[model samples]
Target: MMFASIASVALERAQMTRALLLRMIQMAEMRDPEETGPHVNRVGSYSIEIFEKWGMKHGLSEEEIDKKRDILRMAAMLHDVGKVAVSDKILKKRGQLTEEEYETMKRHTVRGARLFLDKASDFGEMVSEMNHYHSDFDAMAAQVALNHHEKWNGRGYPGHVDIATGSPLKDYAVPDYPHKALGKKEEEIPLVGRIVALADVYDALSTKRSYKEAWDEAKVLDLIGKEAGSHFDPELVEIFFSCLPVLRSIQQRYKEPEMPSE
Candidate 1:
C-alpha cells in the first residue's frame, strides 16, 4: 500500500509540472499568435533530439542524458515564457520592427530568466530531491530562457546579465550596445543554450509565422548548413543533420494545429 501511494503521488507531481508548462504557454499565446503551444512543443522536442545526439557523441552515459533531458525539455518550453512581459505591439506586429521596437523585444530573454530564479521553492524540496541535479530546475530553465538567442559568433542578447536584476552584467557588456549584455560566443554559451538556439531557429524557419511563410525543407537545411559556426554552434549543427530523421519526426509530431476554413 505504501509503495502504491508513493507511486500515485509521483504521478500527480509529474502531471502538475506539465500543467505548469501548458499554463505558461497559454499566457504567451494569448499575447502573440505565433507563440502557440505547438511552437513551444516543437522547440522542446527539437532541443531534446539535438541534445541526445550531442550527449552520445560526447560519450555521456544514458543516465546523464535521461536526467538532463527532463530539465532540458521543460526549460526549452519555457524559453520564451518571458515574452509574457513583452509588449503586445512588438510580439503581434505583422511587419518589420523599428530599432527601438526590436530592443524592447530583446528584453524578453532576461525577463523570462528572471521568472525562474528562486522559483524552485514554489515546487517544494521534494521536486528538487527527486531530480537530484546539482542545481535546481530554476537554474537551467533560467539559462535556456536567457541564452536561446545567443549566436555561436557571440551576438546574442541578454548575455551575462545579473540573473536577479535582469540588468546587463556590464563588466562584459559590448561597447554601445543598447541592451548591454555582451555577446556569448563559442563555449561561452551554455550547452542547453546552444541546443535550444538551433532548435528555436529551426522551428521559426519551418513554421509559418506572422512575419513569413515556412521555408521548404531544402531551403531550411541549406540555411542552417550555411549558419554553422556563425549563427549556430558547428558541433551542434553537425549533430542536428546526423539525427535529421528524428528531428523531422518531432517537427511533424508537434506541427501547428491547422486553422478551419474561413
Candidate 2:
C-alpha cells in the first residue's frame, strides 16, 4: 500500500479503538437502566448544546469546531460509565441512600476511569482526567467533571470550597493562584462535562424517582436559572435555555410519541 494509505489505515484503527471503548460503556449501561437511567441520552444532547455555544462564542473554524463537537458527543456518552462498577443495591436505590451508601456510589468516577483505561489505553489520559476532574472547574475544564458540584459562593463537594483557595491540580492552580478573584470564564471548562452536569441534574430532577416526583422542563429550567450563579455558569445556563426549543424538537423526534388521548 502507498505510504499515505498506510497512515490513513492506522488513523482509522485508532478511531475504531476509541469508538469500541465508548460502545462497550453504552451497551453495559443500557442493559441496566438503574445504573445510568436515560442519562447517556440526555448527556449526549446537552453536550452538543454546550459545544455549539462554545463554537459560536470562540469563533472556531468550522472544521475545528466539528472535531470538537464529535469528541464532546462521545465524551458525554461515557461521562458516567463508572456506574457500571457500583453494586446493583446502590445503583438501584429507590429512596434516599444512607451516608455510607452515597459515599460508595460516588466512587463510580474512579471505577469508570479504570474501566476505560483497561480497554483503551491510548485515551487513558483523557478518560482519567475527565473521570477525576470533570467536576473541578476552579482551574478550568480540567476541574469541571470533578468539581461541577462546586458553588460560586462555595459549599460544594469533594473539596466543598471553590478552587479560589487553590485547585487540587498543581498545574491548574499554578496558572491562577489565590483563585478567589478568578472571574468566571465559562469558556475555560470542559464543554462535555458542563453539558453533562446540566443534563444529568435536569433528568434526575425531572424523572420520577421513588422518592420524588419528576419536574417538567420549565420547572427544571427555573431551578437551573435560580441556581445559575451558584450551581451553574450563567452564560452557559443562558445558552441552555436558548437551546430549549431545539431540545424540544430533539425530544419530539427521538422520544416515543404520546399515545392518542382516549
Candidate 3:
C-alpha cells in the first residue's frame, strides 16, 4: 500500500508539472498575442522539420534523430520565454527603442534562461540547452542562441565581435572588441541553433508585429538569403529556404488569432 501510494503521488506531481509547463507556455503566448500567436509553435515545428531533413540527408540512426528532434522542439518553445521577463512597455513598445531600452530588451535572454532554470528538472536537459543556446556565449548551444545574432563578417550584437577575429567586421561608430572569447566550441555549432536562427527571424519578420508591417514570405526569405554569411550562417540559409513552401503551409494552418484590444 505504501509503495502504491508513493507511486500515485509521483504521478500526480508529474501531471501537475506538465500542466504548469503548458500554462507558462500559454502565458508567454498571451504576453503578445498579436505578435506571438501561433508564431512560436510554428517556429518549433519548423525547427523539427529542418532537423529531420538534415538527419535524413546525413542518414542518422532512428533513435539518435528522434532524441535530437525532441530537444530542438523543447528548446524552440522556450526560445522567447525570456521575453516574459521584459516589461510590457518594452515588449509592446510602439516604435524603435532608444539604445538604453534596447539593452534592457537584450537582457530578456538572460532573464528567460533563469526562469527555465527554476524549473529545470521538469524540462530535463532542455532547460539548460535553451537558456544558453539562444545567447552569444562560448557554450555549445550558443550557435543556436548567442552566435545566431552574429554576422559572418562579425557585425552582430553583444559585442559585435567578428567570428574570425572575435571583433566587429564592419565600422560604423562603436569600438570593435575583436579579442573577446570565441564560443565554447569553435568547431561545431549546434545544427539546431543554426536552424532556429533562420526560423526565428523568419517568424518575426512574417508576423504582423505591433511596430512594423509583416513582410511577405518571399520578401522575408529573400532578406534572410541575402544576409547569408552576413547575418546568418550561410549553409543554413540554403537549407532554410528550401523548406519555405512547407513553412508557409504551417503559417497558414496555425495562424494565430489577433488579441482583442482592451
Candidate 4:
C-alpha cells in the first residue's frame, strides 16, 4: 500500500474516535436532557486539571501526566453515556426514582463501561494499528465509565462486576444490592476512575439540574469536604481545592449559553 494510504487510514482512525464520543453524547442527550455537550466538556476539563495536579503531587513524570490527562479528558466526557439505554421515564423523571428504577438506573455505570470494553479490543488490524494507544485508550475509558459512580466507602452502584457479562468480579455484594456486585471503596477504586468520579459530581452539584438550583462554590465545597474519605478520594479532593481558581476558570469557559430574551 502507498505511504499516503497508510496516513489516510490513520486520519480516519482519529476521526472515528471523535465521532464515537460525539455521537454517543448526542444519543444520550436525547434520553436525558441534562447531559448536554457543554456539561460533558466541563467535566472533562475539570478531571484533567485536577488529575494533573494529583499526578505532580504523587511524583508521576510530566510526560506520564499529560498522556493520562489527555486520555482522561475524552473518557471522562463519556462517563454518563450509558444513560442512552435508560428509559425516558426513568431518565426524565423529575421526582425520586423508585427502588426498581434506581436499580435500573445504577446499571448505567456498567452499561457505559460496556460501550468501550471487549468490543474495542477486537478492532481489526486495519483500524487497531492506526492508533498506538488504541487498546489502552479503550481500557482506560471503560474503567472510567464503569467506576465513576463508585464511592470511597463502597456504597457506589454496579460495583465490581464484569463489564462484559455483568457478573460479579468478586463476591462483594451489599445488603441493599444483593443481585449485583457492590461498588468499590477507597483504594479498590482505580485512580483514573476516582479522578472522573470527583470531576463528574463536582460538575453535577455546581450545575443546575431539573430538580435543583445551581449551588454557589461555598456550598459545593462544604459537601465535598465532608465526604472526603467516604464519597471522594481524599487526596484528589485536596488537590481540587488547592487549584480552586483553575477549576473555576474551566467552569466559566464551558458555562451554558444564556437563553435569548422573549
Select the stronger candidate by TM-score from 1 and 4: 4
Total clashing residue pairs per candidate? 0, 19, 13, 0
lDDT of 2 by residue, 24-51 (tens): 6566576456324245566667667766
What TM-score would you give candidate 1 relative to the actual structure?
0.89
Candidate 1 off by > 4 Å:
1-11, 119-135, 176-179
> Taking the tens digit of each residue's C-alpha lDDT, what string does model 4 give over 1-262?
6999988977888888777667777777777889988899998999899888988888999999877776788888888988888899999999899999998898888888877764554433333555766666778888888889889999886677877777777566656766678678888998888988888889999988888989998999999999999999899999989998998898889998776799
| Residue 241, model 3: Cα distance from true site in angstroms | 2.3
Task: Judging by lDDT, tell me the better candidate of 1 and 2.
Answer: 1
Candidate 4: which stretches are off by over 4 Å?
A: 1-5, 120-129, 175-178, 260-262
Question: Candidate 1 on 73-144: residue-level lDDT in tens?
Answer: 888988988888887778888889999999889888888887766545554443454433424567888889
Better of 3 and 4 by lDDT: 4
> TM-score of every model?
0.89, 0.69, 0.71, 0.90
lDDT string, candidate 3, 1-262, tens digits: 9999977866666556546556766888778544354876888888888777778778898887876675566567656666776788888788889988997776554455445434344544433343322222223233344434434444444343333233433552253533332332212434665677677888889887767789986798789879887667776677777777887788888886866999
